[model samples]
Target: MSYVLGIDIGTYESKGVLVDRNGKLVAQSAVPHKLEIPHRGWAEHDAEATWWHDFKQLSKSLIHMARMNYGISADEIEAVGVSSIAPAVLPIDRDGTPLRKAILYGVDTRAEREIAALNEAIGEERVFEIGGQSLSSQAAGPKMKWIKHHEPEVYEKTYKFLCGSGYLVYKLTGQCVIDRYTAVNYAPLFDIHTLEWNDESVSHMTEADKLPALTWSTDIVGTVTRQAAEQTGLAPGTRVIAGTADAMSEAISIGAIHQGDLMMMYGSSTFFILTTDRIMKTKELWPNVHIVPGANTLTGGTATAGSLTRWFVDQCLGRDMGSGEASNWSVQQAYTYMSEQAGLSPPGSNGLITLPFFSGERTPVHDASAKGMMFGLSLNHTTADMYRSLLEGISFSIRHNLDVMQELGASVKRIVSVGGGVKNELWLQSVSDICQVRQAIPEITVGAAYGNAYICGMALGWHDNLEEIDEWVNIIRHIEPGVNDREVYERHYAIYHRLYERTKDLMKDL
Candidate 1:
């Protein structure tokens, strides 16, 4: 039986899935990783060890699992699809090897100076006109400028600048390409309307040729070469699709294809994707082309979500993260304990509130200097109240983004929740209560890895159109808002908005 394999490299863990033509998941695997903070407000990943290494291990293991348990052979795997965190900056030499550890996405705030300089040089209004969003640390192009200014040797030796998915495509098929949806995050350098890179945007310092060739997310970029086949255990000549960012893949996994479909992806960050009919731009949000041709989407996200929870658990719960695999169960136990305690806390966390900007805020505010704050902390409070307050803080942030979407004339007909956070009953239900919108949880909440597998099915012609996703998506449960708790959260939501502005300067002075 022919199979299509998909893998996604995420913030905390990497997941891979193997699926047959009928859209059934056959085998799956996961690898947990820790974020590397080499400096204050900077995040980096060893490209070869974290990204490529995880892919190699997961691909081989999934292939073996399929062969042994499902009676499927490696040769039967017909196509491969990949997705990863985007707006990443990785400079590579002529041979496509990473020159240094890759500078990660929005969470990495090392490019603040470059972002300011670019906004001043290009004019924020003109940038929004061309790219549909104002420049922020999230854009990869300015991070490119960061290297040229600081790491000149690395810049001189660089040949191509590739993000996660594009780099994977290169390793697999020797084809270097990035999908339009992901490439759009390289703002100022890429023209959203025309879908091409330009030198004029960066004052000609950036060479347009160094950027990967653009392709649609589902397009088959190339077939696997023998070298990649040997390394990955995928069959030689297997079709490899030019995939997209993990958030986009998460959007596709939940059937957020048509206009007005919104996906609330709760991973390391809280991301929202609202599909629209025409281009939409806002200083508070991001705009990009949808995976489908001619469609558009507006996106907003927070830099902290699951990552923030993990930080609290590791710091206060004594997980011994440095002790490795044996300590993982302890960390899991701590999470369960926290969730149970959080459930006991009353709505609004007994008058507690956290800003949820541990890693600076993204979307709407875009304030890098913002710091996390927790108010109403008293000796009488317990860890349970604090944990619940953090969860509510994240929910309030999501509501803020949804409100922005509404102000932009986008109405949400449905909200699909996916990612690691879906299993948290409180987080899902709290968002519903705070936002007053029901959320549907799909049967398979395997996150973006499953979405990448679905993309592979589409690329292989197993599904003529995205409507076929209906077969794979079956809502297991509906999380509805509690009417009685609405007033309490309604008041809290207003305060959540005000607390940020009141604390903005205080946070900056820190």
Candidate 2:
């Protein structure tokens, strides 16, 4: 039987999977990593140490598992597909050595100043016309310009600018390439109409030569080299496709490729991708090209979700309870305990509401200076209330994005939910109640790694098109919205909006 390998580099971890053409997962593995926050608003990762290092580890481990557990050889793996937290800004030298730590996705708001400058220099509407999106922290062009303005020494020596997935592809295949879906986030630098890098916009940021070659998400760029093969334990000359962003892969993992298919990826952050037939230009959300050609999607994200929960554990619960064994419980066990605690709390968090902008606000608000808040806090409230409120806060943010998408005339025929968040029953049900949408949870929630494997299948012509993913994915269950909790959530959601509008200025001042 033939097999393919898929790997994804997430914010806090990386996962890899090996699968047969029938979509049976042969082997799977994961590795944990840290998301560095060096400054107040800066988030980064060492490209060589974290991304490439983790990829090699996961590859070797998964390949070994396929051989030992499933009797599959390395030669059986036909193609490799990769995805990562994307639209990141990673500068590399001519020899493909990372010059500095990679600037992460919208979670890092260090480019706020650059965003304002670009919007001022080129009118916001003009930019929207050019790029089909607004100038926000999510835009890679602003972050690229940030390096040029703040780190001129690093910028001057840069050979090519790459995203997380592109960097991994370069390490494996010695080529610098990005998918159109991922490249669309490189606003102004990439023209949505032409579907290529714009030479005109290069003047505002780095040189034109610094841009990576663009291709479709499943397009095979090259094959694994001998050096990369030795490090990764894969056979030499294995085809490597130009992988796209993780959320895109996650969306495809569950067969959310058609128009009006909304994918809510609840991982380190919560990202929403609404696939559409044509581009919908809105300042509130990002217009992205679909991995499949001649299609578009509107993307939105919160700066924090599961990461905020981690913060709560680290800050509220002490160090021993946060990282180490709390009553001899593993970290996952600790979270399960916390979830049980949260279940004890009533909905609306018993009059407590949280704004999950610990990093910043994305989507409709797009406020970099936005701060996290817990309104209606009282001495009577317990840890359960606080935890539940955090989950509710993220759900409110999801509703806010869905409202924006609906206002833009986008339809939502189906909602395919993926990521670690699906495991939390309280969180999943709360999102359903708060968002008033049913979520289709796939049986195999291994996420982007599985999606990567299928994309590899496509690259190898095992499937005719995106629709074949339906054969691979099966909906195990569905979470329908709760009618009883709607009114209470509606009232709290109002307060959630007002709380932000009222205190945003104070947050900026601080």
Candidate 3:
């Protein structure tokens, strides 16, 4: 029997899965890592260690697991697929090694100055006309401009700029290529109408040749090279497909592949991907080209989602626990206590409100200088209340983003929830109640790997049909808005929405 290997590089962790031709998972493994905050507004990743290193180890372990546990051989692996945080910028040298830390998507606000300069120079209207989205930290063109202007030395030596998926694909196949869906993120540099790199108008930051060749997500870019096989234990010449962003892969994981289907990925960040019939441009939301050639999607994401909760658990609660094993135990105990406490607390978090802009806000507000806030905290408030407030606050942001998408003429027939954060039922319920949108929770919430594996299956002759993927996914139940919590959140959401506006001036000063 043939099997496909799918791996995804996430914000805090990376996961790999081996799936049989029947869509049954044979082996799975994950590696956890940290996101580096070097400065107040900057976030980054050591692309080699966090991305490529995790990939090699994850691949090796998955191969061993498949062989010992599932009785599958390396040659039996048909094709490999990968997905990662996107719209990221990592400049590479001629040898394809990263020149410096890769600038992360949306959360990395170091490029704000670059974003403003681009807007001032090119005009926002022209950028939106070509890129389908306004220039922002999430747009790759500005980030590359930041590199060129700030680190002229690095830009001069750069051979190509690659995203996470492209980096891994190159390591495996040695072919420099990026999917069209991600290519759009480099807006103004990429013309959406033609799906090609625009050199005539926008070529100041870097030459068009420095970018990877654009390809469809499902297409096989190249086969694994001899060097990659020795390090990862995969057979030589194994086909590798051009992978797309994690959110798009997650949408496929839960069968939310049709137009009007919305995917909310509750991972390191709360991301929304809405499938559309055609491209609809808006400054508030990112209008994306779909993995499927003729389709389109509206995409948006908050800078922090699970990462906010994670910080509270690790930095705040786990502080006293010290290092090593004690720290992990402390985090677990803190989460356990908080989860129970949140369950007992009333829906509105005891009249408390929090603005979930810990890593700066994205979509709707799109404020890079936004700061987190906790209003109405009293001495009587418990740790549980604070944690619950965090969830509620994040849900408010989710609603804010969804409102923008709907206002901009995108229809949402269904919402599919994916990623690690969905495991938190309280957070799920809070998002549903606050957003007033029902969410379909799939059986396998770890959606990206399966989605990636399916793409690998496409690389081989084993999968021409996506309908087969539907069978692997089962939407167990829907999280409907609670009648009791709805009105309570409504009263709070109005204030939550205004929190940013009221604080924007002060936030910028910070």
Model 3 misses residue 1 by how many Å? 1.3
Highest-TM-score candidate: 2
Candidate 3 backbone overlaps, count: 0
Q: Candidate 1 on 1-510: residue-level lDDT in tens?
A: 678999999987899999888778899999877789999789888888999899999999999999899789888988899999987888889898899989988898888888888888887888888788887768888889999899999998998888998888899988888899998888878888787776579563477677788899899999999999999998899999999999999988888776788989999999888888888878889988977688889888998999888887766666644223446555557777789999999999999988999888889788888788898899989889999999999999898888888898888888988998998898888899998889988888887888888888888888887768877888888998888898889888888879998889988799
* Candidate numbers sorted by lDDT from highest down: 2, 1, 3
Residue by residue across 1-510, what tens digits does model 2's lDDT show? 999999999998899999999999999999888899999999999999999999999999999998898788889899999999987999999999999999999899999989888888877887888899887778899999999999999999999999999999999999999999999899978998999888777678889889999999889999999999999999999999999999999999988887789999989999988888888888899988888787788899998998998788766666545444444656677788889999999998899999999998888899989999999989999999999999999999999999988898999999999999999999999999999999999999999999999999999999989889999999999999999988999999999999999999999999
TM-score of 2: 0.98
In angstroms, how far off is 187's CA in candidate 1?
1.1
Clashing pairs in 3: none
**lDDT tens string, model 3, 198-274?**
87546756787898999999999899999999999999989899998988888888888777889899988988888
Question: All candidates: CA RMSD in angstroms?
Answer: 1.5, 1.2, 1.7
Q: lDDT per model, in order? A: 0.86, 0.91, 0.86
TM-score of each: 0.97, 0.98, 0.97
Residue 292, candidate 3: Cα error in Å is: 2.4
Enumerate residue pairs that collide in model 1.
none
Query: CA shift at 270, candidate 2, in angstroms?
Result: 0.5
